[model samples]
Target: MDHQPLVSLITVNYNGRAFLHGLLESLQACRYPHLEIILVDNASADDSVAFVRSHYPQVQIVENAQNYRFARGNNIGMARARGSIVGLINNDVVVDPDFLQPIVAAFAADAELGAVQPKVLDLQRPGYLEYAGACGGFLDRLGYPFLRGRLFDRVEPDLGQYDTPLQVFWGSGAALFLRKQALEQVGGLDEAFELHMEEIDLCWRLHLAGWRIAVLPESRIWHYGGGTLAQHHPQKFYWNFRNNLFLLIKNLSANRLWRVLPLRIVLDGLALLNELVRGKWRHAGFIARAYLWLLAHLPLLMARRAANRPWIARGAARTEALLYPGSIVWEYFLRGRRRFADLKYSQAFTRRLAYGRHLSPTQMEGVEQPYGTETV
Candidate 1:
């Protein structure tokens, strides 16, 4: 690879002309010299396509006739990417000019690194972290995902506590940095997910294939959470509930899946009950429908499992190393352990976490050296 490799930053826009100006201005200011911007317009009825063509003639545009949402839309852009490094940035984000530097450096340093995400702050409230992906993503044994600085609905302030870069389980789709070769090996994002949990699934596949995903705190970006799907929208709930199940079914090893899936079903039911009790009947209904959809589509889910098996067989298959063994739901709701640091992590996981700690300047420069496997 070149010292400053070509980075293809792909943003999928769906009637988000309002957010384009900030995104374009930030891209123009980016210090990276070999960057190319690709805008995949998901059949936006707005003047989004015309606006990009008029204002940013240098950007490559992929026009889709219908709204493909996140999974398929990003896959289309990834396919068209000419860079060794492919970036997935949401239209709702404004990136720091220097964000690409650390990302490029990290990728050059580590051959096994599949993806990297910047420190994501709230666009509306710059002092706080964003809910979508605060500082890279981690999942519990049951596949409940939470970030370093954000847990479920509770997002923490950016206190520099999570400033240390580390190997993470997943990179957020909102502002994802990926390696083109790794994506091709894993067959890109699962279009079936449509929107939610797709990034996590991709990262899981990468991990199984002997690649690492990471977070770079030195780089930062602000995200306007829920640009396409509002927090209160019933469709968001449906996708979140339904696709999360799909994620576990597709990626988790068979031995692990059989043990954890039954518990996940019960936990999901409790979530639905909580929604109903809170008088959010519509959200509750979406959860019920999500379950029904999953049950009706078992064959489809099974097909996905079969397709993903070859990668898992070839991979290190160390899923337990990155997974938090305790149930996040039990800790957050029942035990009131909201802060990431407050939880009592097992000694085994603490050692693994230590191995995944951020690289020092010296170590960063030396990352090109062969890396050994961590004990799972």
Candidate 2:
């Protein structure tokens, strides 16, 4: 126990009392001794706050005035956390007894390791991968997010295909384990995101700051997906699309931004059309609204860039290697490449990962070049 670091685990709860008992009970089973659970309740109207206070007095509770959403809610907990390591987990997940072991080990193994996500399996179907983040996340050339065991809508069975630990583009926020140092360095999560895709943005910023994000399949957790929002909810669609666009604009270098942003727009159009064809007219409307909102909030986007200047100034190393060289949308929709193994990367990508580690000093020597179109 002396060798283990104290982990301050935080869960964002919004009317999630029914699942709280299970999560708390599962955590009670964890063998890790140096741990503290912090529950951030986003003004839960139900008896969630009362229940935690009654049954789990040991847990620290942060009550928000209103629904601050995921990013802000977790940021609040991080501010109050006392441990060196921080864990941002959803209220709907249950962890194995050994979950914290591998995570602690991963951080101890690499000084530059900023965050690690466990192998998230579907709670209902333990044999299958979860929707939030199966084994680790990767960004396609078009800025589309996909997991090692999951494509657009396909969740694969857990046959240990992604068992090996490796560097990933992003770690899922569902059961995210992070270093407090890294979290503070990048100013924690971006509040503008409010909900979806915020974790990806945070991880990408960490990458730019010369930190690594890894997936530790050796540590496992079962996530009851869609706890806060339904899979097909229009609000979910709005946040995902909007925040993804924000990531492309705010995070990408000027040269790469110009090249990828146009393709992303066209790809988004195709997705909207597909939704219309499938009679998901409301979803299509959500996407349109997201685009219109982005256009109107150009000033806000500029402000975000200014906020992210610290991480941007740190530059990037090995970040480009984590991205899928091919377009995932085209491969999934046209070529029907549902499995991650089916997706292809150029030989240069393999070589890049091989030699990327040694190029760290050169990459971190400078800041990202600006687009020069407008100032924040």
Q: Point to the candidate with the largest TM-score.
A: 1
Per-candidate TM-scores read 0.93, 0.91
lDDT of each: 0.84, 0.83
- Per-residue alpha-carbon lDDT of model 2 for 184-222, expressed as tens digits? 887788888888999999999889888878787888999
Model 1: per-residue Cα lDDT at residue 61: 96
State, as a TM-score between 0 and 1, how close model 1 is to the true structure.
0.93
Model 2, CA-based lDDT? 0.83
Judging by lDDT against the true structure, name the best candidate.
1
In candidate 1, stretches whose alpha carbon ends up further than 4 angstroms from where it belongs are: 346-351, 354-376
